[model samples]
Target chain A: MADLATFDVQSMNRVDLVTVSGRIDSSNAGQFDEILKGIVGKGRNNIVLEMNGVSYMSSAGLRALVSTLRTCKRNRGDLRLAAPSERVVDVLKLAGLNSMFSSYPDSVAAVGSF
Target chain B: MSQVEAVFPARFAEIARICALVQLEAAAAGFDEKEQFRLQLACDEACTNIIEHAYGGENRGNIRVLIRQRDGSFLIQLHDTGRPFDPSNFELESSRQPSADLAELQEGGWGLHFMHSIMDEVRFDFDMDQGNTLTMIKVHP
Candidate 1:
């Protein structure tokens, strides 16, 4: 069974730190999009997505991430990624979207990038 | 050949159920973690394309995914009653790696790349009498 999806969201001075745990597949990608949308909707554009706890990411997840990235960028804000698991990195790389987001080794570095 | 098949309404929400079913098959086939992830991702990408493209914007349709183990390989076929997509157009560029600058990156298009990259074999077929079928094959490691 897939782990229940959860997002640990924090509001920081510069960015919204979203610590995503469990699998992000087609199953719950809609909810994931909504969370990101809600964050951006609240006028917080710069988002630091922590992916260390993300075990699986499907194309649906990528769509949510890219859509969120586009939304943030349109507002002159950016979305950075932090500590993606090997599988997450592989999916991002395979999709050629790895370079689209600023990625760091840790959350501190990622939050700093913003 | 051992096989199982299911049909789902073409809704974004159904993607989770489809993927979960795929994972079960992969696990029962004794696929390693990496292999299971690959299968799940590849199949998920194909289904997403159908939901987003063939049946875009609250359109109602049906998607059927079939998984079969034959010989030393796994075969996955996705059948959908949405728009007819020429799967050939989705072919991943043989030489394209994922290192391009983000500014140079495009938003969509990556799902097909990921599908082709992860699966050992991917093909598409369309028939007016039937529907669209996307075939993805992965060899047992």
Candidate 2:
């Protein structure tokens, strides 16, 4: 409904780099999903989420991440999580969803993985 | 010692405002950073459900939050009057670890689980005239 989270998507060679900051919750997960759709549309599947700036994420955000992973993998792309803040990491850990995605210590390493 | 309360329109835009108050109350209650985040997430999921399900994302009606610390426990209650849906009657499909199969990855059932998991106790009360009140309790044990 509002700008809960904002992210910049860029193409770095063959990788799609997504730098996201702010909170991701139920209210704006659809808008977040739309942003991801645009990236996948451009044929860059290996997406890296630099989540150091994300202050919080709810189950809705978790769902968005999972579905996005599904979409990317369906297209032979993958979503790599990089440098998730402690809070974000805890949420993922609590949900048991952390291991579902490949996590990197930083964007440099995440982007390098693809 | 004293009660803290806030009421705002049941709008998604007001979530940040509500969450800020939750953070303030949790900190004042002497909750640690992890407990604060758990309280915040529990509150967020509760409020989000009210906005999306109760209000049908229309952003109408009002939601009231009540917070207080009593006997070494933090109590938070969210009240809303959109529709009377009892959480106890609903199944918590995603309460356990999500499935490894990609097709079983879910989205909608997570709010209840988060509320149930992070809080030490969770309960719901509602009536035709009183609306719904979600009570979440976390005791420092």
Candidate 3:
């Protein structure tokens, strides 16, 4: 079975922090989506996605991020990305998503942006 | 130099990892790193769509991927025994529009559009007896 590795979610300074490891593609993209939905469901809008441990991401992963961003905006919240690997950054740039979201060098910076 | 094949789950996560391998190998074959990443994103979108929509969310079938080099180009074929669906039927969204508005963006519906925009050539073959096959090609430019 193709697994999406693991994802850890926490809260800090009123920002919902999500840390994703491993790969995010078709199989596990939905799981990530559900996790984001759950967090948004709790009405926590300020969000930071930390991708330092992520080795790979597909367009499906990008889709999940976009979805989360949309949900945050709908609820008057914001989403930021932090510390993506070079490979992950490359995909974001190719998709032109790098410019669409606020990106910080680390989780602390990202959280502080809130 | 030659051809390679890998089979993985019809799940989204596995497809992403396999596509990453394809990008790495394609980059090593002299393709520009940017183009390589585009190919990886396109492949991931296509394969993930298959696993989700075509496979009926079963998540337990085999997805066969074939990578070959031909005529100074790289060819990838993805084969799955899922429901028959043609990717060519839908009109793809243009990549020219910036994803600026989070309200205008979508999560699931954009996969097909993303795949079509990045690949140089994409085609679909449906075999009632065999399965659905997606063939994509990227020429080194």
**In lDDT terms, which candidate is top?**
1
Error of 2 at B73 (Å): 1.1
Q: Per-residue lDDT for A1-114 in model 2, tens only?
A: 123588888888888888888888766777888888788877777899999998888887888788889989898889999998887888878777778889999999999999
Structure candidate 1, residue pairs in collision: A27-B16
Model 1, A34-78: lDDT tens per residue? 999999999999999999999888877887888898889989999
User: What fraction of correct interface contacts does each candidate retain?
Assistant: 0.68, 0.46, 0.49
lDDT of 1 by residue, B46-69 (tens): 887888887774347889889999
Best DockQ goes to which candidate?
A: 1
**Could you give the CAPRI-style class of model 1?**
medium
From the highest TM-score down, the ranking of the candidates is 2, 1, 3
What C-alpha lDDT values do all the predictions have? 0.83, 0.82, 0.77
Runs off by more than 4 Å, candidate 2 = A1-4, B94-96
Which candidate model has the greater TM-score, 1 or 2? 2
Restricted to chain B, the TM-score per model reads 0.91, 0.91, 0.84
Chain A TM per prediction: 0.96, 0.90, 0.92
TM-score of each: 0.82, 0.94, 0.82
Using DockQ as the yardstick, the better of models 1 and 2 is 1
Residues A1-114, model 3: lDDT tens digits:
233558999887699999988777666777988999899988999999999987667776787788888889888898888998776787777666788888899999999888
Given the true complex, what DockQ would model 2 score? 0.51
